[model samples]
Target: MSAPKQDAWVGHLGPAGFDLRSDTMTTPTASMLAAIQSCSLLDDVFVEDPTTIELESHVAELAGKEAALLVLSGTMGNQLALRSLLTQPPYSVLCDHRAHIIKYEAGGFVHSFCLS
Candidate 1:
């Protein structure tokens, strides 16, 4: 008898078992928790956190840039990029009509940039 095809089986669970609804379903690993506990903690808004600055510096070096900023989410990254590049009011961004940034971001970029 022939062996069962791999595609026929439901593969390994991705983050959240069996539910593929969202990509945010992730659990911290032991190393991540350890780092969180061991790393220097500071209010990033009031002071430059050493770890964050190091990470940003590393990323900047890798990308051949003078600076970098770490954002909390994809939405924040997208918004920051747009805010930096758009420069003026009355601009429009083109994307798929069903894109998450357009449909799911609650018009944040559009409203923030005064885009039409």
Candidate 2:
């Protein structure tokens, strides 16, 4: 058997396909760059960043949580939540078996929180 030929004008191509295998991917649009340039940035450590605070508030309101931490990504957010929930040591977090937090992220949370 032969490898199937890719149609030139197929449904999945270029920006639509989003090939994660290759690094030759599209960059953010000009509007996104402009927004980043124009955005007012404050110290994020103390929750002074307007954008960070806004995102946290928005997520909190949406999730109906008392507070929310503006994490870098879904994995970070999830791991942080788990860490917060576990009071005692030997914190073994339970999550979806194929979750990105478990498979990917190069063990960022594991090293950071010393999770078991």
How do all models score by TM-score?
Answer: 0.71, 0.56
Report the poorest 10 consecutive residues by lDDT, candidate 2.
17-26
Clashing pairs in 1: none
**lDDT of the candidates, in the order given:** 0.73, 0.68
lDDT of 2 by residue, 1-116 (tens): 56444432232454445433322344556776898899988899976789988888898999999878766656666667767787677767677878777688677667867655
Query: What lDDT does candidate 2 reach at residue 111?
Result: 81
For candidate 2, the TM-score is 0.56
lDDT of 1 by residue, 7-114 (tens): 212234334334323445445567778988999988778656999888989999999999999888778887898888888656768889998788788998877776
Off by over 4 Å in 1: 1-23
Please name the candidate that would achieve the greatest lDDT relative to the true structure: 1
- Residue runs of model 2 more than 4 Å from their true location after superposition: 1-27, 89-91, 94-97, 105-116
Query: How does candidate 1 score on lDDT?
Result: 0.73
In model 2, the clashing pairs are: none
TM-score: model 1 vs. ground truth: 0.71
